[model samples]
Target: MALSTQYADEDSQNVLIAKLDNAKNVSNILKAIHFKESATVFASSMGLKVTVEDSKCVQANAFIQEGIFHEYAVQEDQVTFKINLTVLLECLTIFGSTSAPGVTTNLKMCYGGYGCPLQLVLEEDGVLTECSIKTLEPDEILDFNFCSENVINKIIMKSECLKEAFSELDMSSDILQFLMSPDPPYFRLSTFGDAGSTHSDFPKDSDMIESFSCTQTQTNRYKVSLLKPSVKALGLSTRVSIRTDNRGFLSIQYMIKNEDGQICFVEYYCAPDEDVSDPYS
Candidate 1:
């Protein structure tokens, strides 16, 4: 049977259908959270969410809203599936990843009921490519519940400031410590390594800090290896928001702007390393 015909019925019976004018928009965002090979995808009327995790200690989510898609439809309250992100990314950019003059790739993605492979159709410069990636059984995802009400300290800053800090981070460091307070040392990031320790501090009133609301002094430590993946998002982002909750949980949000000047968000959540006691506790 032809590929189109094989999926024609499935398409009509599909629980989710999404289309993108430019595949690069979705490809670029997926790259930000590509640390893991497999990712859980959730589809709803609100949008699509792709989640990746490492060692159950760190989690990253990439959100692509329905508004970003040229056509979006969802027949169910929620549709969940797991797929190899590496494969999906490759299929999304099969035509060509890099930009060329007057060239763009269009994408149509469809998912039938359970146990069906994800169907993808790509077109670029008059060329069409089709891909079917097998979907795996869904896995239980972690819930961090790091809500705003639980946030103790939050800071919004330009990505440029954090980019430098992340780039120069000492890999030798086992843990990255964060200290936020309303008093002196309003915002601080420290890494202790064989060469000793390095600290990067941002003044609350600095131009780089757009907003600072720190009610109490809080200090927490997280595995350096886990948070390193966020650098991908930081590099491509224009703004970043840092928040620490009362439980010492950390959340970092990156605001990325696509080629079309549309804004998308990537976020990371990390559990504190309990081996190190919280100074505020």
Candidate 2:
């Protein structure tokens, strides 16, 4: 159905409505954080935030700013709902996963208050496909309570640097260790597996590093399984910011540039593995 004819009279009833010139932009960003099957979506005038969490220890958020959308409207201050990310992705790429030369898949998404199915309308080359995916009650999202004031170490670098390190990480390792200090071996990634231990270090003055601020030496360990999913976001981003709080909590924020040259952000928050003793101590 045509977007205008379908939503002409229901404008007042819609809690959220967004139109995009190319649906692939949204699909591509969402795919980075598709580690979980379900995600909670929060929509407002600013934009849409989709969050996926696992094991109560790790959380991932994908932010699609309102500026990315051609038309964005929200009747309420905030509208929240739980959705199946797998199903939503399938609907967004119904026409095809790849882009055709000079062809774009247009998308019109709508939500009619609570208890309404999320509506999706996609049109490409005069072909229109409609989908209505059921939405579940919103889930209580986790708050890591990570703040800048508590950050002990922070580093901003090109994603290419970390991408190589993550790609070569040892799957046999149960935990990934991070060491940040002001002295030599400023930043290091270590993995201890059955074979042995592996360490990759980046000098504080490396060209790839855009910013480096370390108040004190800190070494923290995180589960390899929990942090693995973030590699997907890292792979798609141009730059990334890695931060850790005094409590040893880890936060990674990826800066992603979409097809239209618009910037989006995907962030991951992870709690440190408490079972491991502090090796530095």
Candidate 3:
């Protein structure tokens, strides 16, 4: 079916309709948060927010703003649903996962109210493919109550520097420690494994650091397994913002620029490993 004809008939019934000239843009962002099979999606006038969680301790959010879409319409104030991330990524990359120099895949996505499957239309060159994927009822999402006002330490740095450190992280370590202080060792990442304790420090005056703000000395630990998935996002981002709240909650925000040079954001929230020593000590 023609893309226009398909939407023309369902326009009135569809609660959400979005069109993107390059489907790879969305696919690439979604792939960064594909740690979980199922993801809850919340759509609003602002655009789409897809949330993927692991063990209720870590949550990843991918924000694709309305401006990214060539055409975007949301009849309701907000629409929420759960979908299979694996299936959605596959459908978005049906033409091919890799980008071809002259070829582009256009995507049209529609959701018809509640209890309706998400309809996807992909067109590349003269070929067209359609897919309907089942949607599930959304579960209660966790609220970390993390706010900027409660942030004790925050650092914005180039992702390339952190990417190398993350890629070399010792998997044998159960917990990854973060020490941010106004004193010496301004920013540090530590891991204690079978080999021994290893630390990577970034000087506050380093060229890679875009911004650095540390209220006091704060040391917190987070599970390596939970944070490992975020490497995908870090690998694609140009800059990353790392923050830790008074409660020791960890927030990592990645500023990703898509193929069209548009900025998008992916965020990860994680609770501190409480079994460790006092963070303020």
Q: For each candidate, C-alpha RMSD in Å?
A: 2.5, 1.8, 2.0
lDDT of 2 by residue, 1-281 (tens): 88577578776678899999999899999999999999999998899999999999999999999999999999899999999999999999898856569799999999997899999989999988989999999888889999999999999999999988876778568899999998889999999877778888989999999999988899999999999899889989999999999999999999999989999999999999999864423
Best by lDDT: 3
Candidate 3 accuracy as lDDT = 0.93
Which of 1 and 3 is ahead in lDDT?
A: 3
Worst 10 residues of 1 by lDDT: 272-281
In candidate 1, residue 71 scores what lDDT?
Answer: 93
Task: Score residue 253 of candidate 1 by CA lDDT.
Answer: 96
**Clash pairs (backbone) in predicted model 3:** none
lDDT of 3 by residue, 105-168 (tens): 9999999989999999999987889999999999999999999899999999999999978757
In candidate 1, what are the lDDT values of residues 146-170, reduced to their tens digit?
8889999999999999988876777
Candidates 1 and 2 compared by lDDT, better number? 2
